[model samples]
Target: MVNSIKCLLLLSLAFVPFCHCKKEQGVNLYPQFYDQSCPKAQEIVKSIVAKAFAKDPRMAASLLRLHFHDCFVKGCDGSVLLDSSGTIISEKRSNPNRNSARGFEVIDEIKSAIEKECPHTVSCADILAIAARDSTVLTGGPSWGVPLGRRDSLGASLSGSNQNIPAPNNTFQTILTKFKLKGLDIVDLVALSGSHTIGDSRCTSFRQRLYNQTGNGKADFTLDQSYAAKLRTQCPRSGGDQNLFVLDFVTPVKFDNNYFKNLLAFKGLLSSDEILLTDNKESEDLVKKYAERNDLFFEQFAKSMVKMGNITPLTGSRGEIRRICRRINN
Candidate 1:
């Protein structure tokens, strides 16, 4: 009941979608999709996500990241949740996801609780989408009415995951190309990159920036030298591949413009983040705008999230609602 009211409050805000009227690929996905089949669907998802986030504050960012990874590989079909079993090459082992993608147990828990209340009515893809939005709201971020009714994929894509998801060292053009392929643009890229305000990056993801950025054995000059020195204490030259560092050192847990601010200062943890400022004229301008205007970032973030969630979602009878998110239905 509390969550339901919260949902209404958040949805009624100026940024959220107002009605069940938005379309993608000629099919509609509305916040009220489960009003008949499972009235408590959103509430249940919100409650469980809140509980998990309380237990692990990082869970908020992890869950949000799962939605991004899933959508990028195969049109927001929850292929990233699959485990390796019987011809299904899980995206979990892809170069981008290997040892990086997380929050699966939280997702599993949400799926189980939802199954008891609503059976197989909610798709894992839609679950990921809602979880992302809920996660954002839990961490002092904007809220939006997540369009639902997506379905799970029967197969995972390892190669697609590797090729499609942008890498930490990917050139700005490469990252932009990847986002472009997903029907997103520079605004989406900049706003969505702001999600980094709350997440952590592994040492391996940014070690290159601290040691040898240009293959000339010199540290990346773009990074603040003092910040790079601090990072080296834990990251080292090699072997601390799994050491965790906050992406936004200023406000590691808050969802704000600090990420863009950090990039402006050359203190961004990941090369991908730094390049958002140095690499492209348009993205660079966006980084500047978001750094100065928190409200603008939040507004556009909510909008970009909705647009990204609509990437080729399966509707009508196109896909199935898996009883287990880790595997396709029998």
Candidate 2:
């Protein structure tokens, strides 16, 4: 065991690299998990993600969001990647993921590429994690060493996806509570929310804040009227639910602290984004710190992402290395 681990370590410095829930902690995941087993795993994922992002800059955010959504539903087990099969209710059909979650094609490409070189040696869950990190780096965001070794789940959970993923209109407390339930805290909530620095939000997601915030038919007072008006031109009072809006108005494609800066200016697109500052003192302080020091925000964002990626990962013989990400092995 020592010699094998040593070889794995040596190969990890240069080249390479689970099935169940043991204690519900991601203790088995490490950056070098695939060093010897599938030395090219991370390389293949990074290449595919870069190609996809270059083709459609928005692809970066889409891929990043995929990891966040997948981790939330079933402990980063790749449950979100499953297609509805016999007895498997796909998370893709859930309310939170129905029209929002995407990037499956990109994942397919990465998985296929890696399979050509490593067979079933790596997990789709790890692919999502690596792709997300690559996406962030492609978008001018800070990068971190992503812990790996998570195994793909045999079943998907539509109900868990619907219930676990936080909504754009959820209250600050509700959002924070959702994070806490996932073993995260306010610091993680604030740092992870920084992901809004890149993605896009659909009109329906934040329409409540624009026209009927609090059901009073008044725009959210926290939102800048000018910005709201601009959004209204595209979002409108009725219809256009599928219309897309940039999350960070100033730098839509760049991953930076601009999301927090926009929050301070009341230009934040989602009610959930604005409430980070307006609702909780600790949350507000975090917003100000990120907005003021991009370096601090980058540091915390890296730490929070690593923490989030560690959520209840499947390891050991707990799960299977899926032959195909969209379905279980035949």
Candidate 3:
């Protein structure tokens, strides 16, 4: 009995500081507490990324793009995790009716693996970041160390019309302007574009750049040996389908700094991505910096990801703890 009482006293003393702590309203602004770290979450994330990569080789590129678009558009609400009709929410981006369903299908596999290991512990936001990095690594790209602990947003803006998701044809200035709205600077914009190192783009996204926007004094994109010729054949200048072309020549299934290098040599697939390297010296210099120092690219990617994960979080009573990332309260 005496020993039990003494142990209780010690426990009480240990908790005294925490118990006495008072959150002074308006006085202690920015007061924060470090949430307990969960290794299980990280393990599950790694598993998901690897599983997704193995499941579908094609999805690596699209999944990485989805991660970038999600953060850039709505601060990573997992907004990319929506169906075509926007009726069903998703832990992974919806595959049905999507041009990039294969990639989202891989994401669905990852989400399932994570659910089995640690149900509701990993957020869709963190999974997106991890999956992006992993997809790149699997495709022989850089492996960035991304920090975790981002909470999933229950409130996803369904309508794409509401957010500013830039299309493949956006100009250099337009891309920069849209990125700024997300609190990213020129460096972030250029660094993020490195994602193009692996993804594929349809001819629809670049036909204008190849035919209408190319010439002496316009934009000199030195076609990669025969990439231009291939484009001409696939999407004939006269009349042809305008929806078939992969972005990267080296590895369309990986992520790397090759995208910037390609731009340096004039091989960018989309007008917007190419314009960044040629339209402004500052932008060009930033891309060069990322291409040279992949470490810097990884660091900035991690920082940008953290920033993206924090936007418009559902805290307190605003949202409920979702049992699944796809469906709400239901």
Candidate 4:
């Protein structure tokens, strides 16, 4: 028995380097728990995100921003979660755009349903996490099965948003550094960038990258001309929704390898996405790697999500199960 154990240990150690080399391999991050009813909760969460938009169309962008900001800052904390006092416990950031009032209403409705079905049982943080997952699934990728039981955060940090989240126009290295801080590898970074595969961005976000092609601000750039031309029509150099751009062309609502193919065609919409091809050969290699293996991308996406979900989460005694996501329970 000891010999067999030793053999297994040795075999694992022997394969370590190979594993490391393949770490940059593009792969899928689908959750292993996917099933007919397994993603039912996630489906509910997606509806909630969409409803947020439906309630207040303007809040749609901000709500999406809130999700990305929250997850990128400290995993998927329910920091976006509110309490009864109308007071946010964590670092109090600015309120979500009032235009999102309708969206907040939708979020409230979803929470109410869960509360009715399993009052105080589900964590708002998990809801946000699942919402993000559901959003991705709705955008056109395989639905990833997220492990449940995430608790709400009692402490919100406005500071986290400025410090941790990557800026839209930051260099590839800057983005890498931020991702590394989150314990994500290059592959994970590449995979996460795939989120852009189906979302829209404002022209303001990538204008500098578009016009300042030779400028220091635009390092190692290679954006597609056709895409740029399209952007020009909607967002001129002088003024427009610079923050606007689409992540994926095919099945924009589904999360899949289409983002990678976009990269391959030099049609990646974000400066961050285009920069991957120029600054890091490995990142570009990953794009190709993932593009070729849809299943692998789903697998990696699942694992990376698990890792992302575990980030500075409001675990243990840090938070509460809010009766409503927008207001405190007075």
Best by lDDT: 1
Off by over 4 Å in 2: 1-26, 213-217
Tens digits of per-residue lDDT for model 3 on 1-330? Answer: 999999999999998777567532212112021123334655565666676567657677777777766665456556566543346444233221145433555556666766776566556666677777677677876554565545555555534422465566777788788778777778777766777776566666566655754443222344444666667667655465435566767656656677777777777887778788778899888888877877777677656655554554433344443445454534
Expressed as tens digits, the lDDT of each residue in 27-128 for candidate 4 is: 222333233323355556666777664554344433444565667766776665453343344433433211221234555677777776666666676766
Q: What would the C-alpha RMSD of candidate 4 be, to one decimal place?
A: 7.9
Q: Is candidate 1 or candidate 4 better by TM-score?
A: 1
Clashes of 3: 1
Instruction: Judge candidate 1 against the unseen true structure and give its global Cα lDDT, from 0 to 1.
Output: 0.91
Candidate 1 residue runs with Cα over 4 Å from true position: 1-25, 213-217
Instruction: Summing lDDT over every window of 10 consecutive residues in candidate 4, give the lowest-scoring window.
Output: 94-103
The model with the greater lDDT, 1 or 2, is: 1
C-alpha TM-scores of all predictions? 0.91, 0.91, 0.74, 0.73
Q: What is the lDDT of residue 101 in candidate 1?
A: 89
Residue 185 lDDT in model 4? Answer: 88
